[model samples]
Target chain A: MPGVKKVGQRTIQFANPPVVMATASIVGPKEGEGPLADCFDKIVQDTYYGEKTWEKAETKMLAEAVEMVIKKAGLQTGDIDYLFAGDLLNQTISANYAARQLAIPFFGLYGACSTMYEGTILASILVDGGFAEKVVAATSSHHNTAERQYRYPTELGSQRPMTAQWTVTGAGAMLIAKEGSGPRITHATVGKVVDQGIKDPNDMGAAMAPAAADTIITHLQDTGRKPEDYDLIVTGDLATVGKALVEKLTQQQNIDLSKNYTDCGILIYDPSQDVHAGGSGCACSAVVTCSYLLEEMIAGKYKRILGVGTGALMSPCSCQQGDSIPGIGHAVVFEMS
Target chain B: MGANEGSLLDKQFQQVKKQAQQQQYQQMAQSVKPKQTWVKNAVAAFLVGGSITAFAQIIQNIFQSAGLAQKEAGTATLMIMVFLGAFFTGLGIYDNLGKFAGAGSIVPITGFANSIVSPALEFKREGFVYGVAAKMFTIAGPVLVYGFVTSVIIGLIAYFFQ
Candidate 1:
């Protein structure tokens, strides 16, 4: 465990690994029709989910997801040491307001789509370092809320080009305990911002592919592992195009990801469902990892897996100011118990 | 179209299929893109702009026939055109016309009136002074400043020549 302290650059080896006690996911109707629909804990039929606004619906989703995760873990709200949550809203409003109701020590994060894994790394760090006994890492995003804020209003009826990705309307929460019988967090590799001079806001896959590839390469080098080392390697939200780009980039580095690599963005929804370029949102990785991947691990389908959460760091105002989108990826290795 | 997590072979097959579909979408996007019709837009602008000028001419002639001087008639015609423009904009009819006519409606004196009253109407809910009055020149503010400054400079040049 001594050499496990630090791998190559940007990688960390936790001496005392944290365990995922329980996780839960809640998604809207559009996501309910996806391939991973059966994995979700709850699926609301309406975008508003009985709330007056999309933001409120997202807040409701995250709060309910947190409650579900704690209940599934058989832990009371007071038992949790800290709550780490975030969303796509400005000021991380959904997670912040949800935390207000949960009343736990909170850490608000904004890593765009990478928020789930980012929260995972932070929560694991706190638990592994003896800073906390238990922490909840969660993130959520509503399609309508993200659409109006990031692009045109729903009323505008704007025709999104093929390069445009559908923002996921869902929330996922995970309870990381100091010690538990679940998937063990082995190592984490945090990514740096990688900008490939991509300025088009529509082609998010292209913007984020480089970051995912960078983190994956660094993870492999630091951990002294290859593409085939793990049972599976998954990315956060780099759907079809971005996934292909990652495969190509890794291939150039003499790594073959064609066998065991998949992306959450591409896995959640079916292509025939008309989700162009697949799904992209803070909840993409969160929901997929919590619901689908965790269940598979529990079923003994995957023994060891790596999750690379990728995020596009660009705001609508920044894009209008002609700023290029920079992307980041954070990786966490999970081993089944 | 389908990604299977259980079987590695199926996952690889799905990824390969996904790559092919992506290429198809890229090509489709390029082929189906709407082309900008510059010549058509130019004709529309010219016709609508010229028709607006002709209407102003007719108004000027009527005022002249009523014993007004040429300069006074011209100024009165411009005022009438601006009033008509603001009136149509307030009725919400000008925006519809703009959608249909494109640059045709946007190249007219009505478009100038729209430049002033549209933002005012949109922001009127915020309050009168800070909202409507303040934003009244949101679109026209640059026009007024640049228009007056250029005209003053040209006037000085003309006076010096004289």
Candidate 2:
């Protein structure tokens, strides 16, 4: 309790804020063709990205992102104290493999799509506690790898339902330092695992919306802030269906989020992209935040922003066994002032 | 909106969320409820199915003329067709044929072999035990169970009647 500030039960207000020094985003061909293509640092035209398998390609992209962010921050790989990485693959092989290549002390996290923010929270905590000078927070997902692992093989050419979201193929990395000239993480709210007995994996947007709504309400309560306090409120990978649901849920709680709310899932893809619900996976929020939001913040577009990373905690086995998908949302407050 | 307000908002949030989700699922199900292409699919199935049966008859006749009994020729012909289906699936030709031929390619015993071998090939990376072996029977398992049970029932009825 030396410097720790615990707000209510699940939220924490940091005494010493950690700065996001620099960030990098890399995506595959399909993601490159999306609406936010120009924001990305590198867009590999081929999904393989000069690798033989899609898994290998994802590892390459993540490693390259880590390298890019470190270089952008004017720091060497040795300057980073720890690497926090995660991915959508089984055992998070992509992030683990990238860590192997980077040779940094690694901490692997599994929060499904919320893993990017989970990494960010851990990295920020380590820096704020004065334990680390710099930490690299990274996460990745490949369309091919996720489809085969969570759904079906690409060659099957199965028909997808309208509820199914397109797993984004990309990697996003951020270099967080103990002190820097950048946006500071002021507060964080770790959400409860909320399950509405949602069994359909295809409709993950619906499954995760409740968790996001719960977190949004709890964050405002713990911080004693209003919805209008922040310029923007972004949720991770809720897509269209979940975005609508969040709006509905928040309205019931008398929290009007209609003016400033948007989802990274909906922002990443174009309407003409035929992505059904919208873009998803760990890379959805990661790439959008690292590329789009960071640049906009630097340009003085937003002063205070709340990014809530939402995740559906269910594996293919868990979904197959008739177990309901449990959802979680973790919120982090970013401020330029 | 008071800070002291306990789980009131949480409960309300869940209730509103559940109703919204129910509505969304119903809408999604309605939107993606597959189109009625039964008549066109039936036509395709009839033509392709008849053609496969004709082809198998020709192969059985050829085997019979090669100096084998009718029963032996039929079994040998079926085995060869199954081998052909499996080989085609491995070469990535069977899926393409399934696209064009629809029910034609799938109605034969070769189609059954394709169903079993295709999943095994798809999940080969998951390893031999959990990936390939476990998933190999996903499509064919129900067929095998139902076929066995139905045959047993029919055999018992025939034996009693006779």
Candidate 3:
């Protein structure tokens, strides 16, 4: 059957839909504190698991976040049709454990710091495709947890340079539904992972800012949108160091997101709040998107939002082997209609 | 009745006098002869203080060998030094070290780590506002301010030269 013959009386149309529903964020330790300050510190601390694997910490964080998101969405454990999640761990154990507890059909994803955007994009696609009525997308990371798993244990007494970011120990979850009254995820621009082969992990802000700028500029170009079109453009975990670099580099392309752009890494922790410089982690972007940004959107404070998640694609092993650090970023747009 | 009361008071006074005499004798017998002078104590403090930096270097070597980058290795070394310094500080050992070494512990890259982490951990104790919030940027404030100013100046100079 020809295409026109198969749908003689049907027509296709494109419309921007509203996000019908969203939910709460749950974090460890104190509300404004790092996760290591909590009970998990004791659970994972002084143990072989705490000293060896980040998987345990990621699992604990995701379990807590998923529980909160599911309860808030008024859905039961079995109600979710699919689970899309990611983290910075080797096998993405955060998503794995969350899937085990939630018992939803699962797809594990990884984009390093950009995991949240990757999950959100997939969730939106699932909803738009009519493949699922409800999908839960979540991501999380812990500083001590990731450190022990990915780098060194606390007992090892490793020193941190001025350029190194204190990985934020936290998690964030969001429930994306096909029929919701909240702001719809209108469009997403997938970024090509770019590597300038910068080697220093201590100066990650400089390493990743160029990739962030590339994605932001290209997203605007593809969508035929200008910076002024959105109220704010938020980037994932650039911290104070990266935030400055991003602003400076973007100006070279005549694309200035600085006036409206803010970094999740900087906003998550008040430097004066004793968090040292700013926040970094998959959770940095996730929590800010679900809690801070979502709240602002609901209040009519912002009509349109652009969230760009950036990741530095360098592993401890990779860096140690004298390999260059490649950078990657993904941009997703959400609008209220 | 008056005769009996006077005898009772005399008995109590006699008992107190015997107790004081016994205490004095015990103190005299227990006292030890002094061996080392104040100079020895000061010298001991110096040795202990200097050892911490040496220990930190040992740790840095291990980190370097383990495949950490130079900056990362340096940071790890500094963290160990700061921790050792703080430990000594808590034990009142660092005070003596600070006096004797006089920035020996404070002058190295490790000293930089101590300067940042100590204030941060201290402010963290005061509660979020005065503690974490107020002190979060306590150490990094100067670095950031100076960094920003210097970068701008450099950028402007470069632009003008061009």
Candidate 4:
């Protein structure tokens, strides 16, 4: 059992990596109006997605994404073995309720914004280990639902700080299988929760950048690779501020990420969108990866990509009690033939 | 000093060094973080909030000119202002205004009405009794509680003095 699937320190090197069979994205009107609008499979005009409440709307979007991914793979719901998913809500109720509707064997996750990659790595491990032949990895975030739960009511006449990020109202899902002709999940490095003692809930980028840098560094060190090894290295939601910090932090460690590193938050929106720092939430990375990046990978634009899902692990309760925000970044490498 | 004491000294030194490094990281984060738009927000708040207060004064003046008592005119003006706030909130304009106005929109009577009405409208989907009624006072509850408590304290002081 020694060094069978494990890499140096805390990375998993899949001997036979699981393939991403299909991907589906369902985004809200605001996201649909953004730069990558045409990339998504479906775009709902309203944030409610025809549901009564924003919470129910988020559940619907996730459930639809899961079903769409399965259908895109030309498989029935009963054909999938496990469903790994999460969302940025209380008790992960969005994922839990969607699982109830989907009726698949489920593993409810709570990795804050980093949950999509967490689900991906776990799905890859299960598929690679021959435990589950096919499974679904998905996560969603609703702008109104996140606001009501984390900060204030959606219509509260409050101004967000310039450093504050706009949560993406969308869902992204992927079907991963043991044998498929698609981009394969090759390796992953799960990050440690790194807290640089940043306390402001508004400045989430700064809080998460250190963790992203640390995980990137460790991934490189563990796998004995360099930044040039991957065609593109993208962080989940560092936006502008955290992206700069990751560049600086990694540069200090003599690992120049200047050539290839980018952020999903920055890429998701244009400067005109006025998303201050940039787009965030679980859907930020998931939607961007499932839509834009995956399409590019299949089209031979990018062959090797290291997608780092970063998360600021502060709750409303923790921030209210004056505790510093802890951050995490989980990385998953995807390579196309 | 003995070997134990020397090792203790080294440990303390390491702790101090780590603390300094941590402080450096915090400062770096603060530096790179987008600076607060203090002047812009403050100016906008002043202009917007001041305009709202001035408009209320005009409304109060109009009621007084219509031959109402000063207290009656003030109450009527506030009611009009609250209605306008709730109206804009319902029409989905106040929150957008607030995004630019900052505290300017939030400090006025209209902002207060928006605070109460926003949650009421948002939570309406959950059910009237538990959703709207229960969540209505969430934003403005603290203001009402503290306002009443202070009034009671001042009233007690006045009673004892008299």
lDDT of 4 by residue, A1-337 (tens): 5587888889999999999999999999989898899899999999888877889999999999999999999999999999999999989999999999999999999998999999999999999999999999999999899998888888889998888999999999999999989999999999999988889998999999999999999999989999999999999998999999999999999999989999999988987987899999999999999999989999999999999999989899999899999999999999998
> How large is the interface RMSD of candidate 4?
1.1
- Local distance difference test, each candidate: 0.86, 0.88, 0.67, 0.94
Rank order by lDDT, top first? Answer: 4, 2, 1, 3
The sequence of per-residue lDDT tens digits that candidate 4 reaches over residues B1-162 is 699999999999998997787799998887887878999999999999999999999999999999999999999999999999999999999999999999999999999999999999988987999999999999999999999999999999999999
- DockQ of candidate 3 (2 decimals): 0.01
On a 0 to 100 scale, what is the lDDT of residue A118 in model 3?
A: 82
The DockQ ranking, best first, is 4, 2, 1, 3
Which sections of candidate 1 miss by over 4 Å? A1-4, B1-162
Write the number of the candidate with greater DockQ, choosing between 1 and 4.
4
Could you tell me the TM-score of chain A in candidate 4?
Answer: 0.99
Candidate 3 RMSD computed on C-alpha atoms after optimal superposition onto the true structure: 29.3
The sequence of per-residue lDDT tens digits that candidate 1 reaches over residues A66-177 is 9999999998999999999999999999999999999999999999999999999999999988999999999999997897678643322123556678899999999999
DockQ: which candidate is best? 4
Candidate 4 at A62: error in angstroms? 0.4
Cα lDDT tens digits, model 2, A92-130, are 999999999999999999999999899999999999888
Query: Of 2 and 4, which scores higher on DockQ?
Result: 4
Ranking by TM-score: 4, 2, 1, 3
Model 4: CA > 4 A from native: B1-18, B152-162
